[model samples]
Target: MQIVILNDAAAVAAYGANIFATQLQKKPTSVLGLATGSTPVALYQELIAKNKAGEISFSQATTFNLDEYLGLTGDHPQSYRHFMNEQLFSHIDINKDNTFVPPGDALNPITACKEYEDKIVAAGGVDVQLLGIGRNGHIGFNEPSSGLRSRTRVKTLTKATVDDNARFFAADEYQPQLSITMGIGTILEAKKVVLLATGENKADAVRAMIEGPLMAACPASALQLHQDAVIVIDKAAASKLADLEFYQHIEAENQKLQAHLATL
Candidate 1:
């Protein structure tokens, strides 16, 4: 596990984009595990701009989204599928068919979940996964108490989660009560993962994820066990972290070392 604290949100987003860009440069056809929400919108925008400038090309890249709200279809205005298209896919050169978001309205969700996991395997697993940590320390709708080794499956959203998401829907639209998310175990399978958090609102969760004990109550903490997992956040989000200065020094020294090694 590694920590990167930037001055603010825009810087965080750019750094996140650079992670993806570097991966794409090395493997243009890499499979990406993507996330949604306000936190990643800026990162997606940065990526889109890079594609427009020819700095990067995702034409051959494949993408798998983290989760989708149950009862909403791909075409639904607020569905994750629509969110991906509007936020990133539509603006990039990537083939629309290469992107995969879980079927939100699958009649037989049991089969759908299994097939979703199979698709990731068929793609040879994710090269990198982008993530956003909820204020409650949840990742991919895998709320508190969710099993760390679970797979892609249906999960009932906690009332706290639904209440937190209420602002995303119209007054009359019901907040999602359930969702299909790649479980903690499934997420850990990615070769690399970058988890982003920003603003003071996420400070507590950020601290818990990076420093707190590894328990199911804080699912994001599971990233500690991943071979390559990094936490990227802004100053405010990282405010609660106790080893703030040490994290900065370590990241800087590692970068210097990597630069030195590249010439060898």
Candidate 2:
């Protein structure tokens, strides 16, 4: 895992956006794995700006979201599909038909889960997966203790996760207690993975993921097994990491090496 600690959230977002922009530039037909929530909003906005400026295009890109609330329809304002459309897709040149999110209203959820997995494989797997870690170290709704080698499937939401998401719903609005999510095993299959986190609230989770032992207790720790996983975060989010300075030094050395190669 490459730990990239930036000065602030804005810088973190820009760095993350640049990664995607570069990927899209290199492979216009890239199969992207996307994520939702407040953390990734800025990055999505940056991509939209790039699209508008002709710096990048998603016209041929196909996307699959990490997860969705189990009880909501695609048309529902709270649904992940609607969230993607409102935040990224509607503003870009991508074909909506090519973007896939697990069906929340599937008549047979089990079969739907299998179909979701198959579609991903048929699309050539995710070239790069963008993710945002929850405060509890959960990724794609695979909460604490989630199987490290599980597949796409239905999952029960922990109380902490439900409470964390409660802010998104109105006081009397319905909040889903279940979700369909891509599992840790599925995520590790991606050729590259980029995860972003910000704020002091995520510090513990970030530390646990980057420094703790690889265990199912911290779902995000699964990224450690991936050959190309990048963890980007603001200083606040990386505050709890013990080898923080070493990580920064490593990134600096990597940048210098790339620059040197260009000169050669």
Tens-digit lDDT track of model 2 for 9-61? 99999999999999999999999999998999999999999999999999999
- Residue-by-residue lDDT tens digits, candidate 1, 1-264: 988899999999999999999999899999999999899999999999999999999998999999999889899988999999999999999999999998999999889999999999999999999999988899988999999999999999888888888888999986679999999999999999999999999999999999999989999999999999989999999999899899999999989999999999
Off by over 4 Å in 2: none
Which stretches of model 1 miss by more than 4 angstroms? none
Q: What is the C-alpha RMSD, rounded to one decimal, of candidate 2?
A: 0.6
lDDT of each: 0.94, 0.96
Best by lDDT: 2
